[model samples]
Target: MATRVLLLMALTLYIFPIATATFHVKGSVYCDTCRAGFETNATFYIRGARVGIQCKERKTMKVAFYSEGVTDSTGTYHIEVENDHRDNICECLLVKSPIKWCSTPDSGRDKSSIVLTHYQNGIVNHLHYANAMGYLRDEPLPECHKLLKYYLADSDV
Candidate 1:
């Protein structure tokens, strides 16, 4: 009887894992023409930009799992990870851009860390928001100076 009870418990644990959570990482990409840190009126939401979510091994820092996607019409990309990433660290990173003029990833906003397999109050469950990443346009538009004034708090009106 004792042997049968132990076997049943082992099988039950194997069949049904303790953790049950899937993650949804959602974010957008943009083009920064003026070389300014943040978005301006001249900023453009880049459609079809390549974005990826990568989870690295905690001990070695080597990539363990990854997935990529192209931005939709609204410049948004959503990646769904099927397993719990509790033992690893993951981030949403800029991969590439389809537009010729805007192909350079902005160093400041290239990656955003995401926490999966958790629940927070007032926050959606199993959902992570990556900061909007941007690529630099080859050349800044002539009107960029005027449009950039909107983002400056000290600018003279």
Candidate 2:
């Protein structure tokens, strides 16, 4: 009986770590220098851009977990969600950017929803990718008007 209990305890320890896995979330931040509402030649990825994850409880809609991250030199921010948040919803939210001139979140393009828990998909080492968020330039670039007209003309057709 002691031997059976000892074997069961050893097996639980080995399987527990494998079952409770972590997921990695990666995304980038950029500067919409042209304010064209999308990326163009004038757009530039921003380094040291502040971003974060906010998880809220589904029932009461209360915030549960929040973690901040800063973009790297290449404008990428990688974060890990260790706890399973299947019962909640999490979003990658834009906080701020180091660029003073371009430091406003574009309306309707600020945050992205991400699934960090294994309940949706039972894959380990899961990688959740978020959309590239950006800040609007203080003033629209002159060339942006011309660029936008091109898109507008195409849409008018």
Candidate 3:
């Protein structure tokens, strides 16, 4: 009985680390052509936009891990992060925009917080999805007022 228990323990030790060794963080970046705070019908995905994942120590506020990725043709970015960052605060940040006219980062939408620890999240696939980040256009599109009217109709304002 003792031998069987020991064997099971050995197997768990080997498999647990391998299962939680790495994680994948996925998200997309967009261009707010309408200059709206959020996505709209006229909004479009930004290809070649730069995005980054940064993990910082919660107590010391020091950077622990950092990596960058470029958006694909679909404006989606997938970053693979090594190890479990349970003790760090991780975020997906907007780095750059391919469109010069929409290069400014959107306020309150530039960075998204993401949890990277597999054990804490209770997720078996080890995939973490962050909120979409965006950049604002220097000038609103010609039909922005019309598009924004649709949104305002739902609000009291």
Query: Which 10 consecutive positions of candidate 2 have the poorest summed lDDT?
Result: 12-21
lDDT of 2 by residue, 44-147 (tens): 89999999999999999999989989999999999887777878889999998888899999986678888877653645456889988888999988888787
What TM-score goes with each of the models? 0.80, 0.81, 0.87
Best by lDDT: 3
Ten-residue stretch with the least lDDT total in model 1: 116-125
Which structure is stronger by lDDT: 1 or 3? 3
* lDDT tens digits by residue: candidate 3, 55-156: 999999899999999999998999999988888999999999989999999999999999887554556566789999999999999999998998899999
Off by over 4 Å in 3: 1-20
lDDT of each residue in 40-62, candidate 1, tens digit only: 87788999999999999899999
Model 2 earns a TM-score of 0.81
Candidate 1 lDDT for residue 57: 85
| Rank by lDDT (best first) | 3, 2, 1
Query: Model 2: which residue pairs collide?
Result: none
Computed on alpha carbons, the lDDT of every model, listed in order, comes to: 0.83, 0.84, 0.90
